[model samples]
Target: MYRVWNFINNYSLLLVAGALIALIWANFDTHAYHHFVEYPLWFNDWIGGDFTRWANNYGEGFEKFEVGDVTKVLSVHYLVNDILMAFFFAIAAKEVWEAVILKEGSLRGKKAATPLIATLGGMLGPIAIYVGLAALMGSATFDAISRGWAIPSATDIAFAYLVGRVVFGAGHPAVRFLLLLAIADDAAGLIILAIFYPSGDLAPAWLLVSLGSAVGVFVLFNWLPRMMDRGDQLRPMSSWVRKYLSFWPYLLAGCASWFGFQEAGLHPALGLLPIVPTIPHADRAFGIFSEAEQYLTDLLNQIEHMLKHPVEVVLFFFGLLNAGVEFSSIGTPTWLVLAGLMIGKPLGVTIFGWIAARPLGLGLPSGMRALDLVVVGCVAAIGFTVSLFIASVAFDGNVVLNGIHVQDAAKMGALFSFAAAAVSIVVGKLLRVEKQHG
Candidate 1:
């Protein structure tokens, strides 16, 4: 019997708080709750949802303000989901970049090979079950919810890590393997979001602006200082830039990149990704997604530290905006999402992990067994955060199927993924996993 608040009361405590409040509010007073979520903050052409699109989605009752051709409205939802959420993704992208590129990076070398393969299984399994089962329900049912195939594939890194600790103890090899798989899954989820879901019509040319900003920042702020400081034991130029200019140049580049994505018809939440690698970083990271990272004295980590609190607030608002669902909304889409996560994730991870360990010649981490992969999959199945985000993107409308809103139903499934935590604990005890304290 895992407690809801207990599970959510960590780094993501605010997020879950926001979600729980949204759920209660929506269920209690559906009309008022939606009004709050979609309330307009600003009306400008520079950055917001298109006025026509917002009107169409919300069904024509929303008031539109026009200031001589201002055709966009920045709703509370857009401010969080489309704008502020970019910072959240930027931080996620930062960790992923460090984990992959920095020396002693977790995702490097043959040691990462098996977990990487398991990540693929984690992804493909969900898609196979979600889409395949929907297809079996006949073409019409499939047509309505086919876009949500990616929802179940997401592994909320924070929640999964917490559950991994509970299931295998802090020091167990499976815990590390689960973290690696979840990180890889997050990387894959980002790519899937970028490639599959476009905010509007395609405009690849605007991506050039994002790329150019990245290049310009690297040359002027990052690479130039080091080049100028070459052969100088004092390293004065780099130090000067670090102290004086600081993260300003990169921040400016991030804004430009964000606008580029907004104008490019891609999801603007991923906009800051290009600018992350442009900033200066430490040569090596202590651990991937570890607390010791806050101690590192690199501009990248410093920027992350700076944004940590603001991002937490942003995540809170994001949850409030996206997770407002009524229980009646649960239907076929809900079941499909749950089935994909609970059933497909564990089965795929166990089978494919075994193959990767035995047939492919790659092996699990020391003290981890084939059965442990099942528990890892169970932990990974708690897909609350990223799954909720993707559900919002995949079914972002009031479209009703079988007299229920599909988006809300899908989000409900994501929220229900918390149940996987209890499942993981039970599975661990059933398998008699030896707990190893760090």
Candidate 2:
């Protein structure tokens, strides 16, 4: 019973279950799925009022100010994709910051160069393959589908980590390498999202305001601690006061940044990212779950621990919201994404890794062979959560582009990551990459 509970609690399992439920539910009753997602939630008598009219009236203040005017007509889907997923991206940002900046981390200094290069290949390869295929179809199709070039560029860290554990065991060097690559991939994906995907005309003033808020939080959280250490009399406070009060600035700044991004026509999931590296973090010497006193001092670590389970739940809902697609809706863009992820990912990883190791003089980690790189590449092909998010952004509601059809197809392609997982398992078994038990 305990084992079953643990298995169910596992992150990968939870994500898989959520995706499975969505797939089944969507396929079983497509109408029900659509209706459930589109069900309106608002606080007013005008439940099904014209949205554009409401927006215009609210903006111009012609109608009386009321919180009830705000409505989420497609409540469930948007809530999960737009709001809940922000925390997921925040967590990813935190992980990337820790890997690159922490002293005892794997990706710090010269050691990071190899994995960073590999990540570049991992990104470029998919774009090349996807764009090349799209180009062959015709100029119009190519231009439209090219927006999703980054869709296959992400490797879901949890899924890839699980597959790595099974293939290379718990303590293998390959696992660490894969982890670093995934982190770098995430960093790249975030950049792509910010640069390529904007909701409306970019508002520089709002972006500046967001940056200012992040800076303010950094000053409060980081500078305040330094001041206390210097024995500044004005900054004197009890330990408990300092510990608890420090969290508020982060919350405030995060809210400001989210709003700012919304106003700036950018994806708000990236709002907390610039703030993560600024938050105080403990050295890696204090193990991830350590109860050591220093662990309590690290606000970023504390926030991450606090949000872990919540983020997991959000990811489950994320899968449920985004993974639903009809088989009949799939087309060329879907096949292109599948090919990009499944074939291009592994090929790019292997080829680029060789370039880095051989000519670039960055040697492979100890106990890792060339063929092991191939297996790791296969694992890297498992792109799910972030891929789907990119898909949503890429095809969202542009009428001239057959946006609805393309969006459904892109989503189907993202869900097809299960095929990549199966391929990884097969490759791992063929290579005899088994867990070593003492």
Candidate 3:
């Protein structure tokens, strides 16, 4: 456990390495690595063919038999976004808490401004780019079909870190700050996810139920420490309390809230809010705990710890998903998509981030020059996972938004972002060296 934490802490910068590996596989790896093959049919069927069939019929004939509707191919994306990714949220929430609450005082000042400004820039970067696109070229049809404006806002935390560590090296504070900024950027994007792409339909009773569930989590999390201190014996209150206690229980409660919110016409992301506050982390890691207590604490700690390197895992799945795209169907080389990611993303990030940063007295990192920021901006283009995620939820299985298919556009944009960042990183490095000699 400690080794995993250390690896993530020291090598969190390797996300780009993972992303690049995934990208390579996506483009070329057919020999051994499984790929995400894009079927003209629903994406769900393409990814989880038989498993989906089983999930939809597992409970048939049982008293409370409830099977998920699997008619839509996009359901697989939801499983990743809503179910599996919730754990990502749990981890992300823990990190954000660490940055803001646990390390609040120590993390302030000029040294910390990189992560702060970078995160802000990442948030603003995508929004500015998309809105700009909307103004310049977004047709009404495109706007209606492509409802996702915030997809580009996210930074692939894992990939960015990998690039920074390998290409730039960990000794560079700027690189480290850049990685942290990526993580913060992802958090900001998650906020956008919660606010923007909520499931349609707002039911009052469901809203009330969600509220009640939230209250229960709040009460339970607050009192669990006390309950543990009091005794092991389950009280009338204890049974209810136990339901709210434990990581998995809290996760279940979060799931319930997600469903309630979905039914109530609120964003499912809100379901994560209650548990976000409760995700286990020692607010003050001052003292050690007893062996028994420490074991439980470690369990909570693991959730947050694993999230630190989500880029590797996310990139792998993204590659798998990307593999699903049928190249022959799209009359374009995947490289065209890569080109856009390479050029468009960095241009957007540098312009917006520089514009935002210049107004303030904040300066770029010591060794990082303006051109380096451009490279960093280039790295920002790797938006495959989050962009795809946004596209899936925003379009609701509607393939074409405007004239272009939403999924196609998303894949195109992501590949473009990746290419733009990769080329820029190499170019930026050369420029950095020449500047030093000059």
lDDT of 1 at 272: 96
Better of 1 and 3 by TM-score: 1
User: How much lDDT does candidate 3 score?
Assistant: 0.52
TM-score of 3: 0.67
Pairwise lDDT winner, candidates 1 and 3: 1
Ranking, TM-score, top scorer first: 1, 2, 3
RMSD of each: 3.0, 5.4, 8.2
* Best candidate (score: lDDT): 1
Alpha-carbon shift of residue 357 in model 1 (angstroms): 0.8
Listed in order, each prediction's TM-score against the native is: 0.96, 0.86, 0.67
Across residues 133-251, which tens digit of lDDT does each residue of candidate 2 receive? 99998988887788888898888877787677677876777877887898899888999999999855688688887899888877766776676657655545424435677677777
Off by over 4 Å in 3: 1-77, 104-114, 138-141, 144-146, 203-211, 224-246, 266-270, 284-299, 305-323, 328-359, 365-367, 401-404, 433-438
Q: How many collisions between residues are there in candidate 1? A: 0
Candidate 1 backbone collisions, by pair: none
